[model samples]
Target chain A: MPAELLDGTKTANEILGKIRSQVAVRVAGGGSKPTLATVLVGADPASITYTRMKRKRCESVGMRSLKVELPAETTTEQLLAEIEKLGNDPGVHGILLQHPCPPHIDERAAFEAIPTAKDVDGVTLGSFADMWFGLGGFDSCTPGGIMRLLRAYDLPLSGKRAVVIGRSAILGKPMAGLLLAADATVTICHSRTPDVAAAVREADVVVAAVGRAEFVKGDWIKPGAVVADAGYNAGNVGDVEHAAAAERAAWITPVPGGVGPMTIATLLEQTLVAAERDA
Target chain B: MPAELLDGTKTANEILGKIRSQVAVRVAGGGSKPTLATVLVGADPASITYTRMKRKRCESVGMRSLKVELPAETTTEQLLAEIEKLGNDPGVHGILLQHPCPPHIDERAAFEAIPTAKDVDGVTLGSFADMWFGLGGFDSCTPGGIMRLLRAYDLPLSGKRAVVIGRSAILGKPMAGLLLAADATVTICHSRTPDVAAAVREADVVVAAVGRAEFVKGDWIKPGAVVADAGYNAGNVGDVEHAAAAERAAWITPVPGGVGPMTIATLLEQTLVAAERDA
Candidate 1:
């Protein structure tokens, strides 16, 4: 029998519904609608689309969106100034900087400029530390979404051998920290990892975030493992060989309808949280 | 033959000598001596001793030390105020807040109050994120010391399997981050880990920081594995069973002179680096 599909779309919808009602209550109580300011540098087609989707989600949930689009050649100082503006805006409860902001921009500097209180997208170093130490702070969206999905599926994390494949700040690294916080024995693997398959074979939970399509073979998965594929490669391919993995794993997430949707949903949810705190 | 002892005192002395000469050069070049401000909220004997040792090391390296001793009943706000004073001082390049700052004190809050640039002990959230992301920041003292030991021993970290026992922010967690940054497939095990021995058995390197005497038995170590006991339990016992582990391991750290001296050495070394950057 195939693995039980952990439907991220359904889970995300449920989370959105809760956030929507929370926003409604706040508005009904004479509070202004929650606002998220998204800053996009350059005209990257994918980034533009992502920002649009996030804005649309905000509007759909009765939240406000503040869009700031900059030219491709925006300097790091200019970007930081824009982020600082949004951070200090009384109307803006949360800030999201659509990533891959041109190769020339000092991305980390820009991230650092976002105030920790307004960092709903959780890109700031403060947020990263909070996540790593299990302190109360917003998490990077994808990792936060992954954790929520695991909870929704009732997967036991404590004492489980979890292998996170990738070391990207937003995904693999934070995922490992989250798992470790949840009491799982966490191992982080990357391209430099000598034997990714060997590591995966020993994991009770395998999180594939390496951005390579079908990089983790189905046969490499431990039987009855919980597989979370956080990759979105070209042609809708995921990091895991899903069909093959489904044959061996007890639970798995589909490529398109899984981690992707949850990422956006988590962003929206955290925006509401920031709104509740700041608004 | 027993396992080769990874000598921490010798390595620490070597590092101190280099730092001493660097300090001398800076002083001769008309630069003011670097200063490390040590903040102690309580007069816990161990904390007092640790601070004294750090101050002595600072003096030995031609750096200055400013000690701030507070009452045991110091409030979190009071502690924060004291740290802020040190942080704003022009002569203070680094700040070290002795840990176990009274049960009533909010240690994390106080640690966070230190400026990132002056966080020579690497206790600030910013430093933690920087270290975890391999973005070139001061590491927590013990973990930084452990990494230096590994490098000094010429242990190949790339693609090696490293198991870190314990999850304290200052020790185990950062140790895992440093190892992962070095390209080791790093696993973090804690009290909640169901089969720590099993994890240790598969490791190419085992770092025991659980603060328990002889918690990691000799049989748990993989033959020829590098053992780093970061623990200093009562009676000067380390987390790993030294005698037993030595029988099977290729390298092991002694309890007293292993990680202890290196911790203070790294702390002093980082203070000089901070002074170089900020002074």
Candidate 2:
């Protein structure tokens, strides 16, 4: 059977709708406005676009957005100080550092500096560990969104075998952690894995986040398995071979409309959550 | 061919020897003795034995060990306050909270109370995340010992498929993270895993940490696989069926002398490391 589309676009819209309603309710009740503050360390084109989109989503949900842009040559200490400022701001409930700071920047150091309370983007190790242990903490955006999509479609996760490709801290590692938290027996395959196809064949759910377009072939996917293609490459492709995978997968997320939209949606949702928590 | 034994006792002795020499050299150079402070929240028999063994190991290596026994009725806040005092002491290089604090007390909060600089036991989420990212943080004891044994035996890990059966914070989860960091394709199978045996059958390396005696049957082991039985159930029985598994495995860690000794050894080694870093 051809796979059903996991409509990330529709699901994301539903999430945004809920956030918008909540924001309106809070405002009516005279509660403080929800706000997400984003820090952009360098003017990378992709990052600039991403931050703008995220901010637009915040506005769409009736929350405030703050943009802090720094020059490309900013030092790690300087970047940390900037994030610290957002963390200390009484009105900024959530903080995000646009991904992929310039090569010279100490990105990890900056990510660690964001206080756990305001870490809406969930880049901090404390949040990652909490995600693993099923303690309530913000999830890393991409993985968190992927979990939401899976739940939106009512996919079975408990006791199922899940294979997650790639182990990047933000995406793959947290993806595996989230799946495990959902009671999935998760195998994390990476570049060093000798037999990714074999692993995928056994997986009931496959998450392709290796960032290589079409790196995961369609045939390797188990029949009727759910596939979440999280990689966004140039030319509007994803980590999996979309057409072929769709033929075999029970449900598959399309590259352009799938995980891409949910990242921002999850970010906005978490920002609202932080704001509510602060209030 | 019968599997070769991964001699945990001998390896642990070797590690202790190294730590002992380092401790002696530091003292000879007019440095203060490395001190490890252990907090015992309640008098569980197992906890007492474990702490005693660990502290004795410290003494065997010429390091100072302090044991803090709190009443079983200790509140989370009270325990945290006690831990904070130890954390603040300049004389204490490392602090370990003996595992399984009385159920009424919040264990996670207590574990988090141990400062990162002094968390040689690696129970803190920060340390676990650091282990995942290879960020030079202290490793959780049992998993750290398992990794050392693997390295000592010169077993092939990179590109190998490892199945860790359990997902407890101290053992299974960290084991999978360490294996992944070592470039192994890692699978974490827990009680919720429907086919733990099937997962084990495909593993290049199997770590039995589910805490159930002989839970991982011998037939589940892949031929030529390396097995590290991290479970120490009652009556000297491990999670793996020893005789049956050892017959088919290429390498294995025997129960009593295996991962057991390595845990205390790694703890002492990490304590010395913390001391050195402090120095």
Docking class of 1: high
Provide DockQ values for all models, in the order shown: 0.88, 0.95
| Candidate lDDT values, in order | 0.92, 0.93
Q: How accurate is candidate 1 locally (lDDT)?
A: 0.92
Per-residue lDDT for B234-275 in model 1, tens only? 998999999999999999999899999899999999999999
- Shift of residue A116 alpha carbon in model 2, Å: 1.0
Q: Report the Cα interface RMSD of each model, rounded to 1 decimal.
A: 0.7, 0.6
lDDT of 2 at B49: 88
What shift in Å separates residue B136 of candidate 1 from its native position after superposition?
2.2
The model with the greatest lDDT is 2
Instruction: Flag regions of model 1 displaced more than 4 Å.
Output: none
Estimate, for each residue in B1-279, the C-alpha lDDT of model 2 and write its tens digit. 788999999999999999999999999999989999989987899899888988888998999999899999999999999999999999999999997888898999999999998999999998999999999999999999999999999998999999999999999988889999999999999999988989999999999998899999998899999999998898999999999999989999998999999988999999999999999
- Error (Å) of candidate 1 at residue A158 is 1.2
TM-scores for all candidates: the values are 0.98, 0.99
DockQ of 2: 0.95
